[model samples]
Target chain A: MTMVAQTGANTGVQGNKTPDPAKRAASWRAVRRAAITIGLALATYELIARTGSFPRALLPTLPMIVRTLFAMLLDGSMLMHSLYTLYRVLFGFFLAMVVGIPLGILMARFRRVEQFFLPLVSALMPIPSFALVPLFMLWFGIGNLTTIIIVFYAATFPMIFNTWSGVRSVNPLWLRAAGAMGADEHKLFWKVIIPGASPFIITGMRQSFLRAWIAVVGAEMIAASNWGLGWVIFDAKEFLNADIMLASLAVIGFIGFAFERLVFGSLERNTVMRWGMMRSAKS
Target chain B: MPLIEVKDVSLAYDTPAGRVQGVLGATFNMEESEFLCLVGPSGCGKSTLLNIIAGFLTPTGGEILIGGKKVSGHGMDRGVVFQDFAQLFPWRTALGNVAFGLEMKGIGKEEREEIALQQLKLVKLEKFANSYPHHLSGGMQQRVAIARALAYNPAVLLMDEPFAALDAMTRDDMQRLLADVWKTTGKTIIYVTHNVAEAVYLADRVIVMTPHPGTVKAEIPITLPRPRDPLSVEFLDHQKQLLNYLGQGTSKAA
Candidate 1:
């Protein structure tokens, strides 16, 4: 088993021992850029607050939006809406993973199967989830199903494409080596193929999750039966409540950012970074 | 009885240019624990021969026998260390790469780790047990590759230009390391290389091959003592003779 560490160890002279200045600079630059961006945003908000031409109701100040957001939080509406959006996004994301990964692997491994599904995938891939809202409403009669379906539609493509590409891109040598070691087809798929393809699959999953979140919000705005962040923004639009709408927008952005950083970021760090497939520029 | 036998083996590939003969009616045998070197020019079917013995490629004609049984598909009985590093699984640690064979053998994790560590120590790479393949140099990678093969405890070791990519100093060190490992382990090895010096230094018998429908040109017995010096007159003479044989074969082909 060439998989063992003994043969893979470095017994000979070492090379490439330079200190990584790029990594240090990258983190410093990130912090500096973040500070500058925040400062500029605050400055813009202050400038808008000082202006008198725009109606205060239509263009509420950042402070006003924050105050409204705080009020909503205190009333439990913000928490409820946030939880509703999270549920839809998570449910859709998991559902997409369940359907997409195996399909992708099948497409990658079997050319005939890919050929059979090519037209269907190509047709469905480009059609926006929002574009399907009318058809979905006609079919499923408008509710959680419609929203979940939209999210599922938005998330499925990236997962399928990425997983397929990952499986296809596995080195032939690894397969040969595994075969030589007496790995059966099943073991080869589990041990060599899946692990080798995981980084790409995970990357695809992350992208799908982000897209699914966006699609869920769009779906909610168009077809929500009750409360969600998207519904809050849509409801505020009717009352001309710019503060509530802006606060909902900010919440959406924050949720997306947090999911990317906290979930996918840690996943990449622990797996690909530890495997040495990817290096974190930050460190 | 011979430990391994290749009887009238021939190989061909379906190329765009039609059937390209790789090895033509090649035959050889190896006694148990014998170190045999297969030396030839580029595209002389040296690698094809090794692959056939390793059961990676099926011969178009003839058969290979391992311990009197006909060779079938690839098995752990013959471990091949390919040229060009032959792709180390990037996700695995150095120890994990070496422990792969043990894992396949259904050895428990603790026992596999113990054997892998011992093998790493044998190759003087115990310090880099946690390191990945990309972090290691070409020579180090090949050393790990060699160690990976050895860890399988295969009946025969097939090496195809295993140290061809190393610098002169590293190559010499590897040659010495291989010799030490071979003497200690007493495993049968069939090494393939174009390097005459390496063939003379490492092999008990050097099998000279010619390209263009490859066939065995000569089987010169190496009568040198253990830890043979490359600078010695006897070694140089053998080296010269093998080089002359190769040169003559090439010219005749032309």
Candidate 2:
């Protein structure tokens, strides 16, 4: 009877099994949500257009924004500005990573270093990057340097904070296991600490990239010697070219979304998900 | 010389309230190739003692010697199987995880892979050589962890309730598999568990410890034959005796 009951239970579990149905349902839900949201947004726009409360000069139609975006693309100004902005963000992002990861590791491993940096990090973290734009412009004279400095300023804190937390949050058991296995300091850091902290570091990098991108736009608007997306928007604002301004804004949002989806999404999928650090929320 | 020796060892950790003693003046010795089980109530510092032997912690007092040399910290000579599911590195395959210790020791890749395969075969996990830890079940993961530790061919293998996480049938299977491996390798093992039947079934000598400033309370030799039946009268008697000892310890604490 016991053996039969066990067999019955096992068969029940086997029969009930379905592979990743939750993931399939989640994806379907997302598609449905997107369709509804986009449909409602278009209907609202049409309603506002018919009412004529929305001025063509101040808030151009979606079609006008698209047309303006296409024109800018054809003229090559959008590409040039995009490339400039990309250069500043990437350079500043890499700079923050190089400094932040090592500094975070130092802070995590050593008590004295953590104590010394705690005050400084706490003081600097709350100050927004926009506040540093004027100082950077004064120091570097309103060029790419000022914009890059602003991006760096915006990117550094999140990276530092996330990296430090990642390092600190590593399972103590892993460290103990490593130590029990005769892992040296170098091996411990590389094999255990770094791999353990990778998810948080990647998360930090993603956040820092977003912040730096915003800072670049803000800095470019304030210090407009360089041709960038922010500069295009600023120029359009002065000329009262609503289409161009809306087009630039659309391009910014699209690029930001694309970066998040294409770059960081793949990184998370390939590293954390593959390593079992995270379960797929889609499921 | 004894394979491993603990002389009046005591350990304490500093809590927010104050220093709390974990283990107190525990002494024991194990010969080479002996299977020793350390059994005690929960929070009696069985895990703490295991950690001290594994060189992951230092005792606040007393001394430990492995092959006549004082243990200072962790070394490759002592391999440990942690109680919790300490899966192999997620990034590495089963073969890679088992071969990691060898890789750290600078063994050639080909030789390490061959040895890793052999170890996996010993644990009946050869088919999972390329699988990641997450891809395997809890029992399979623990098997892989065991294979990884055994692949190094360490002088002593320390396990802290290695089978505590598995289902009953899986646990029984693991216990038998472990016995088979021990028979083949004859590696000195110090296993920690709270189960009396398991302790009697596996260990050459079962060392029981008391709680509240934990210390060794009794060491009983298992004279029962190998591949002993769980329902045997002798096994039941030993289990009853161990239970009595445990009950007395608890009552005293209360």
| Per-candidate fnat, comma-separated | 0.59, 0.45
lDDT of 2: 0.84
Among the numbered candidates, top TM-score falls to 1
Per-model TM values vs. the true structure: 0.92, 0.90
DockQ, Cα level, model 2: 0.55
lDDT digits (tens) for residues A1-283 of candidate 2: 1322322232222121247786556556766876899889977975776577867878777787788899989999899999998888888888988988899889989999999997999999889999988887788887688888889888888888888999998888777766666678899899888988988887787888888988989999988664999988887877789889888888899898788766876777677667777554322
Error of 2 at B11 (Å): 3.0
Report candidate 2's fraction of native contacts: 0.45
* TM of chain B, each: 0.95, 0.96
Interface Cα RMSD, each model: 1.5, 1.6
* Tens digits of per-residue lDDT for model 1, B73-182: 89989887877764677788889989988888889999999999888888989999989897888888888888888887999999999998889899999999999999
**Clash count list over all predictions:** 17, 0
> Would you list the C-alpha lDDT of every candidate in the order shown?
0.85, 0.84
CAPRI classification of candidate 1: medium
TM-score of 1: 0.92
